[model samples]
Target chain A: MEISKGWNARKKKQLQVIIAFTIVPLFLLILFTYYPFLEMIRYSFYNMKYIGPRKFVGWRNYVQVFTRPDIIRTLLLSLYYMVGSVVQVALALYLATIFCFKVKGENLWKGFIFFPYLINGIAIGFIFKFFYTRGFVLDTVLQVIGFDLENLPYWLKDQKINNWSLVFTSIWRYMGSNMVLFLGAMMSVDDTLYEAASLDGANKWQTFRHIILPSIKTIVTLNIILSITGSLSAFEPPYVITSGANGTGTFFVVMNDIAHTSQKVGLASAMAVFLLFVIIVAKFVQDALFKYIFRNADTDDESADVARARKKAQKAAARKAKGGA
Target chain B: MAKTTAAKVRHHYSAGTIIWEIIKYASVILCSFIAILPIVSCVITAAKTPEEYQTTNVMTPPANWLNFSNYLEAFKTANMGTAFRNSLIILVFVLLGSIIIGTQLAYVLNRFKFPGNALIRNMFTFAALLPGIAMQVVVYEIMTNLHLVNTMYGYIIMMCGTDVMSIYIYIQYFENLPVSLDESAFMDGASYFRIFYSILLPLLKPAIVTNLILKGVGVYNEYYCANLYLQDKRALCTVATSLYTFTGPLGSQYNMICAGVIMSLLPALIVFIALQNQIYSGVAAGAVKG
Candidate 1:
């Protein structure tokens, strides 16, 4: 009877702890995140500013989101960022490949490159503003290299060059972090594969293609998908540096403008919902395709690359065992 | 023949290999230079006076490296004291709140096989996929309705909104931890809170560090929502929005702006330089796991 009473007390205490620990976080999530998101969906269907009465406009907000030429044009801005993300990923991969090899001052190089990722986005906006100002940092650097300043395009003013300038900053800011990730993934690849590949007279390209690529394929695919979403959500560089001037206003900036500046809360919410929908669709499709490919890919257990890696690892282990013996 | 070739390839420093190695090193160094150049230029520009800035080229070194007057003026005009204070308050509270809330929620979710555990987990996963920035429109409205707009408590509450990443990190950490510890403790008549605080929470150090670095950096550098929610410039200016004080009427004061920028960059730079390994590995782990 005493043991039963003690067990009951323990159970009650456990229940108390669980409820106490969980209740606040759950409340905060419901209040701040989920509730607001649901409101976003509801607001998307209404015709209301931040204030005053709302009319239930049904699909009108969504129609406007789809039909408006200006709104449609804003989305094309994502193309610039999309192109930028591709280049960023490519550059990151290249750098990662180089850094993975024996390089002088590799740590310093990694630190320098990754430093920008740590800087406040607002500070970067200011720094780049100074850097891209005419006859300033970029121009001065070019002139020092014997390039005539007169021939240089205005970095922030010329529409043709401005987007590229913004894209370059994005690339600069992100490339290092991505490289660090790629490098980490690459480091996990067994070293014996490289040794064996070299023994088979495989050149650098062939070694990378056969050995490095397969090991890091998961991370590479993940980066690509993330890059797509990142491109869609590009905001900081444009918002801070140029305030989305000179045709730099991407989708998010436009939505921000609608909500804050124009006071069209309902329309902005619709835009938000639309963007969210696109992102969800993109995520869904990527997940589905990845699931399909990964499912099939797993079935190919006897693939040559896997076989080589396995054999190389086994050989290394065997050598270690022999040495120990 | 294979042994001979392998040995030959290992031993020989061919001209082609030498050239390729040089090119690889050169490319890495060149990119590093590109990365550092703008900041180097900013440093140079920040050192110069207004007269020096107007007369000399941007890349020119200052006459006196000790001229800290611009930094002082930037600090004063930007009211960065308040900014730093506000930012610290926000960071401390947000980090504390996230760690507590995230670990607790993770604990319950991981330990219990409740009716809605899977549902809750899926809900967070779905929330992670939602473009959070896009929902800012409605979030702002929610804040307005709650009278949370332009309030510090509101901002802190919002910032502490359960981070999906931190929760996942904790949950992942918990999964790796053996449940026998808890079972044994329970048998010893320890309360659930005691089991958590004494046994499980201490084991969560590494996960906590990872979450801290990732979430701490994010909250520190977060500008958009901070600017939107905390509209009172003097009272609520964060380290992020404080620098924008120069972006308006003082826009042409490049000298002062550069000073402000450098001041802002200093803390992050110091942290990175001091704890390079911890930061780098933490970041890498977070990225890979996420």
Candidate 2:
């Protein structure tokens, strides 16, 4: 971890210039990022009094979180979101594969796919909410089909269905992005490989499997890990969908659910910490599995893909190392 | 044989290709419709008479209602004037501060090759590591202590701290530039700042613009932080905040909200379309593999 060896004192002193640039800024980052996290973990063990001394509640709060239906529901809703994210990213890979081929009118397809990703999730939530509730392409058709404006289903509204609606919006915004990633990965594939495969009478499916899929294996895995991690800890959209200010929603739906509404800052902090742990563990396991499956088969990947994949794997490993530390 | 095979494959487009192409084109068009639908619905709802909107489907209305007056009512009623003023100020400060400061930090990190350079660069990369919401409770605590809560400056400062993406872009671009440019200027006895100003700064022009477009549009579109931070109605809020009032209970005026959504997204959308080329390349450059 130390700098290159054999530098004199003056040389090392000069090295402070670089250290200062990163260390100083990093102090700010850690202050904002890690400190609160540590505080939240610490607070999770204390009683719920803002004024009282930090008393040890220990396993009591953790027990409450795991056993309580409402808290358990929060964890379940997150699982639903994870499902949506995985599916959406998978679809994106399919779309990205097509884009990689640079079929006719790629500009249009690329724009359409990434269009939702450009809009913030909250805005997309509001936009979709408006469309489903009051607006539509053919109101009369819906009416004839027995859909009533007076009793619109709450995608972000009802507890029973709010999660599904939020999942759709996530897919809408994220599908294109995954597509773009796949496209980028596909572009990195050498043209000569496809040419060779074609000479062997590989059809599009065979080409995709024998060529495109194998080429972008590392990227696909990276996308999967990111999607899983991001979705598990997802927030904001459902918060907007239900309008958390009015209150009927999931655990993450309300911002001040911890310090304010639930009056369980400790509980909320526990929830957040739990989410962080799940993400880290999921990513770690995902990286190992991906590396195992594709490592040998993909050694022949072009230098760029190899470098990119190694960087991704290294970062994932570093994160695991950090978690362990 | 390779050429013949390539030709043979090209000549024999299978049912899969045809089906795949159909699905791709159809979905592309279908998705475009879905993507553009909300904006259209919002606009229609805004322009059409309340009775027309309530009685009919939002997407279809008499052609006569495509008027701009819904915007006037919305602006006047929603306190949009104040929101616009607030957003404008936020944009100006955030754009100048985040980029200007981020670029400086990026320069030292990329060119200096110091001992802790990897850690510094990793700090920016790892900003995206934590769930942004997890950090919010604490940032809220800090901002509250700073007395920046609900203030325009509070919001701008919060945004200025959104340097992770901008810093990443700057580092990527700076890395692409040769180090000789900076060393030669330094050898001429110029100060670090002087070399940055006269040589590196000029060389970094393209990146600066790309960063501005990506970062500007991103900061403007962001709502989560502002929603969390802002409270006072009298305090300056952005156009984005103003648009939400339409969806509020009893204030759910579909027409006005739609018109307002259109107006709110216009600036960013126009910038996006104008620099679509640069944006594609700029964004490609900023692409994080994961």
Q: Would you give me the overall lDDT of model 1?
A: 0.83
Runs of candidate 1 with Cα error greater than 4 angstroms are A1-14, A191-202, A297-325, B1-11
Best by lDDT: 1
Q: Write the per-residue lDDT of candidate 2 for residues B56-173, one digit (tens) a residue.
A: 7666754566577778887776687888788788888988876667777888877766556687666666556666675576677787888988887877767776456678777788
Model 1: per-residue Cα lDDT over A124-233, one tens digit each? 99999999998899999899989998899989889888888998999999898988888877776657566666665555565566556766777888788888877878
Q: How high is each candidate's TM-score?
A: 0.92, 0.83
Error of 2 at A11 (Å): 5.5
Error of 1 at B46 (Å): 0.5
What value does the lDDT take at residue B71 in candidate 1? 91
List the DockQ of the predictions in order.
0.54, 0.36
Give me the runs in candidate 2 sitting further than 4 Å from their true place. Answer: A1-24, A49-56, A101-105, A134-160, A190-202, A244-251, A254-256, A297-325, B1-20, B113-115, B121-127, B162-166, B205-210, B282-289
lDDT of 1 at A3: 96
Candidate 1: tens digits of C-alpha lDDT, residues B1-290: 12333355658888866786888888888899999998998888888988999999998889988899899999999999898899899999999999988999999999976677787788787787776777777788788989999999999999896767778889989999999999999889787888998899999999998888888889989998999899998889999999979977899889999999999888789878987877777777778644
